[model samples]
Target: MIWNLSICFMSFIFLFLTSIFLMFLGVVFIFYDLCYFIEWELLMLNSSSIVMTLIFDWMSLIFMGFVLFISSLIILYSDEYMHGDFNIDRFIILVLMFVLSMMFLIISPNLISILLGWDGLGLVSYCLVIYYQNVKSYNAGMLTALSNRVGDVALLMAIAWMLNFGSWNYIYYVSVFNDSFEMRVIGMLVLLAAMTKSAQVPFSSWLPAAMAAPTPVSALVHSSTLVTAGVYLLIRFNSIICDNCLGQFLLLFSGLTMFMAGLGANFEYDLKKIIALSTLSQLGLMMSILSMGYAKLAYFHLLTHALFKALLFMCAGSIIHNMKNSQDIRYMGNLVLHMPLTSICFNVSNLALCGMPFLAGFYSKDLILEVVSLSYLNMFSFFLYFFSTGLTVCYSLRLVYYSMTGDFNCLSFHPLHDEGWIMLGGMLILMVMAVFGGSLLSWILFPSPIIISLPMSLKLLALFVSLIGGFLGYELSKFSLSYDLQSLRYYLTVSFLGSMWFMPMISTYGVNYYPLIVGLKYYKVFDQGWSEDFGGQKIYNSSVEYSQYMQWWQDNDLKIYLISFMFWIIILFMFMVI
Candidate 1:
């Protein structure tokens, strides 16, 4: 008992203090435009050396600070959330290791060291996802692990490709070899790695499937650590992918990811999955703008999104805890009446996700949309950007409608209220940040105001779309038990939308089908057909027959020997007579 409380306190206190120090250093570095790199060579053979490197700049430091800050709060929150769990210490340690891996990825400029962090994230995330010890969790863990393995392979290939350059420090070569063919290959491989990590397009399935993890893990994984690791990598390697094949394709897939996740969230009933899809949507937004060569904007949004999304998950976690571990929003209604504080926190976080004006998401999401509108682009890209934005609002409002309003569908007179101040403390911290984080980040990130010269119609487009989306969300929610819901009426379309356009199925079964079919056919032709006649089966039959004859002869060994001796003697006499 003492050990459990002590570990949580020790981790939280240490990390909280460290995060504040790092944030202060980050601000100082940004103000002075400073960067420092430390390289340690472990092995030198001939002219090339295997070296590990860490880069400290404003970006890496600030991101590290945010990750640790969230981690600390989550550890504090977990003290209450997992109070009765058997493996509380193991859970806390895994969370710490997850944060450490992210820090490794954030600070490293070398591909080798970055991969160290990347693979650590994959490994730790698998452990966390399957922490539940259930069939569903096992499957989700496998999917998460395998989907991320694609990125690992891509990273390994990238490191192999970098061998020709006699260096693994990709930062030094990005600009120097931008147009070279070799660099292009490396850039594509890195982009592949980022896309899988960030859960863009086809790779997007695993993000929601990974909801099998505990909510605190969800908060960390979705908010700042695992999912964002890819986006952070892209931000670092942004120079290599700009205005090239990698960048253009990034836009396409990320836009699709955004639209798909937003649309999916609307139809999702599972509370955690909806939020997971929301995280996917935000990641797509980050990747889409990053594709347009706005790494700074992406980074800004990443930080702000991290703040609120963490809060959103924390609130959701509290609700789930109070509601007897139920996550279905359908069975939950009028929660505002029972869990007022949590409902308030949830609404605030949801609005922040929808990019409500003056919220943290607004500064970055709005800025990104406006900047993209300013650029010369095709209509499809433009529509995808805004429609996806509206979908974000749509699902958020729908979530509010389903979970906070209507009737109390929970158990009769079930007590669903705040348990203690500890969990609420963690949530309140993030809620405050969610409300003011954007403006704060905006002021610091952009010291000078961004003046956009746009027509009034274009300026109001975001607001107009958001209003329409909110209206649609309400319209979508007006149903009773008298008749079937529109979702049931249009089952197929809803399924298609709800299922991330069948990506999980396609990536899993669709990908497996052909290879498995080919293997089955090979087995039929070789193992069952030709091998049965000419290979191991036939050889086994012959060996069995010969062994049986030897056994019979051995059983009649004395009689057989007498017969053989008489035959040999008769043959010798016949030969002598001849």
Candidate 2:
């Protein structure tokens, strides 16, 4: 017992030290990149000698910095939030494990290492989700694990297919698979995995369930780590996907997920769940950009989203913590007055999420919209973007309004204050990034001196649509619009018809459905008759019959064994002669 305790203590110390070390390394790397940004040759030469070549890229650096920054903040936040709580040590260990896995993931050279890191993250996240050991938390963790498993299987199949085709390395895979039919299939499979991981479309139900985790875990995993894996995957394989039908499919699916999830966020009341759904929506937008072959825009969105979303989630956590575990936004109001610093940080991040002009999200989102406009695809994508942007505005404002603007009704038992200097320190850093990350990144990547301009007409249109959506949502909230809408019914009907229309094609080319049908029929038969009817009859009938048979077999056992041995000897001799 003493040895085990010592080992645990040592692990905690190691993690705490590593967190600080990586954070320092990350800041230094960022500064290094910034200095080298002015001279491309120097940057390239320096990168060549770096221990991890994969982490040398500007995109990797950006994401790594975000990861380190937020993770360090989370560690500090956990110190206060989890103080004196049972399992605090274990929680810190898991947090360290999660951060280490993400760092490895950011710098992994190939798919194998990436998968290891990815799966490690999934495991740690599951642990954190069920850290409290409550039934609800357990169920949520199970569902998340199952969903991630499906994605993992898809990823494994894609990796195997790539290796079989002699494209094992990341760069080689992209170059070789650009024009191959097998590559297209592999890309689609990867996209499926990405979709599930990012909580897109029909696979999105697990994200809200994941809210059962502790607030810090929710903030860290949902925003900066787990959900972003799919976006990272999409960005990593953008070249191969862009050259295939998978790109178009991704565009459609991503746009659809964004629109749908934004709507869901608009309707959700749980603060953490709202942020969870928003993460899904924002990730969908990022994926759509990647699908369009705009790798720079996608990475920019990833960086900016990480900053703003993490801040927003952490701020939400502070509010919930102050409210004594109440996450319902209805119970929260006038927090702007009570927690002034937090309110500013939260509102700034919220505006950034709303794509307000000159903020981080605006730059990234506008770039994507611009690229989408230039794409040769159908107009449906454009329409989806327009509608999604409006919905994004509505949900983003919903968060601000419900938590910061409404009347203060809930009585405070304890005086509310902003979280400690350590937590606020993290939020302040993110706030700075939320203000400037996009502009700095764009300057680094875009060749020639590109002017940073927020077009007045575009701003006006976005703001007008946003205000309309927000106002409408506010008005609608006054009434319980609980009745099922005809539009939703139509959506379901069309979706069913679409599935039916594709069934014949799937049956002919995809996996065989005959065996599945047969198995279902057999299961129904057994469930209805054999098990049910036999259980209702004498329960000992089969046992008695089997016992009698066993006694008869025992009487003849010696004779049977002798005959079987003789038959085996003769067969063995015959086979040898042949």
The CA lDDT of each predicted structure is: 0.90, 0.74
- lDDT, residue 215, model 1: 89
TM-score of each: 0.92, 0.77
Please give the lDDT score for candidate 1. 0.90
Q: Spell out the clash pairs found in candidate 1.
A: 360-438
Clashing pairs in 2: none
Give the deviation of candidate 1 from the true structure as CA RMSD.
Answer: 4.0
Q: Residue 97 of candidate 1: its Cα lDDT? A: 95
In candidate 2, position 230 carries an lDDT of: 81
Candidate 2: which stretches are off by over 4 Å?
A: 1-55, 412-414, 450-460, 477-524, 527-578
